[model samples]
Target: MSKVYSTQELIEILAQERRSCMNGQRLNLAASVSGNPVIDRFLKPEGIQKFSAYNDFKAAVHSYQRQHQVSGIIWCELTMKGKTLRYPAIDEQLAALDSDLKILKAAKADLLEFWYTGIQGMDLYLSINFGKDYQKIMPNDVKEVAQKTEWANLYEYKNYNFWEIILQLGWGKPEEASYKRGWPKSGSEYIHAVNPGKCPIC
Candidate 1:
């Protein structure tokens, strides 16, 4: 059976892997190896000798990862690009994510969910199916409200943020929406937000 891990759990696993990578930088090989051939192979003197002098083993490992495109995750399924569909549970979460993405899109943003998980914390704001369909989503009342007023802390409403965008440059808060009721607001703001240094490079 396949294991289902939460995103937070996966993040913790990644952090543990990072700590192990850091520890591997010391290259502390064991004094003795078990009789197992696999263990012996790795414990070979020549194998140790090759990496003995490289203090930055983590960097070398990262370089190897880059060279081979090894993402490390062992996916159980075979490759099936556009043919694959998300699980129902995953689809729900993705829809929620898309709702947040749409809010950011409304404000011309490059921000991700990491900045603000949701209005009341994580997964607290889930106003899925904003409108009748994907093509014409977002209620006219909310859109009209957004157009007339500059709403800040949108994530507080389980929406996304665009305070860092150029349209919001003069805006005091970093969580304000860049647009007021319409798309683009202006290409100039888009340009400023996308410039290398103006926005959060992180």
Candidate 2:
């Protein structure tokens, strides 16, 4: 006879497996900031003018890591008012970038994943696997789980990759018209149109 496990038990088991699989891969704590000067100004400290220098930003991130005991950081760039803006101040950006790199070095993890998205219609996606986690949770497995879940719809892009679908669908975007209605359990198979909001993964 086969052993039976309750839903909670199964969930716990999966969580444990995920944690073990994620071992040495680093945590997923990330920071997302808007590129708008107005937003940046609002976030600035009172009285002391000028946005915090990039060096300052690095120090702050380091401080945060020290206090929270988290791994490296994922930096995400966003647009303001539908217009894409270049990351100004290369020196500062590089400083923060270096700080993150140092964190990764200390943690002994591989490269950190950096992500940036243009206007609503323009998006980019990339998949990152660390340690042996990929073996347990493949892209197809994620698709299958998403198919079994429900979520909301936002928008769809022509180029849909595993990471892109995961991010957008996680945010409640509706699957594109071209997407199929089945979950892929393995990379060998394919899913047609997928419904974002209803994706079983997110």
Candidate 3:
């Protein structure tokens, strides 16, 4: 029988994986805000005019991941037509982006729960679906789990310090879950409250 872990177990597993991959090196909090030049190319004003579709965004992320030899988490914040959007779940967004970019190899979706057990912290659970392709290089089961199990949900704790993507899995449903359970009251509040300081971004 296949091994199935609980949500908390999955979170601990992913967190350990993240720590191992980092080699104990602390991640730069500003890396996401600084943005990748390749990513910035598509996100800039002119680039936005040229590549406005979500597929384009996905392509840029895939390309960036390939070149950097890094994988795990990705975060995006954007404004279009005076409407602003912040993507807290980096893995899910990337999965959707991969589909849009036609790069999705294997796709899967499951409910995931996230919680923060710290003062001035946050605790909420939500569902997240994950997908991946692996460029046709890795083993089947490895790719399957990599695409499906590797991802983290986003939580904005404080201003200008949004927590980047972190890895989590096997999230079960909460008693009082809703479609809009964990979202903040406003964009400003989201930016202020969701910081990496409060959450792990691996």
| Cα-based lDDT for every prediction | 0.29, 0.30, 0.31
Candidate 2 residues lying further than 4 Å off, grouped into runs, are 24-202
* Superposition error at 92 for model 3 (Å): 9.4
Which regions of candidate 3 are displaced past 4 Å? Answer: 1-58, 72-116, 119-150, 157-202
Per-model TM-score on C-alpha atoms: 0.20, 0.16, 0.21
| Ranking of all predicted structures according to TM-score, beginning with the best and ending with the worst | 3, 1, 2
Better of 1 and 2 by TM-score: 1
RMSD of each: 19.8, 21.6, 19.4
When 2 and 3 are scored with TM-score, the better candidate is: 3
| Candidate with more favorable, higher lDDT: 1 or 2 | 2
- Per-residue error for 8 in candidate 1, Å, reads 0.5
Query: What tens-digit string does per-residue lDDT give for candidate 3 at 138-192?
Result: 1232234434333323333233644332223311211111233322321100111
True-structure lDDT of candidate 3:
0.31
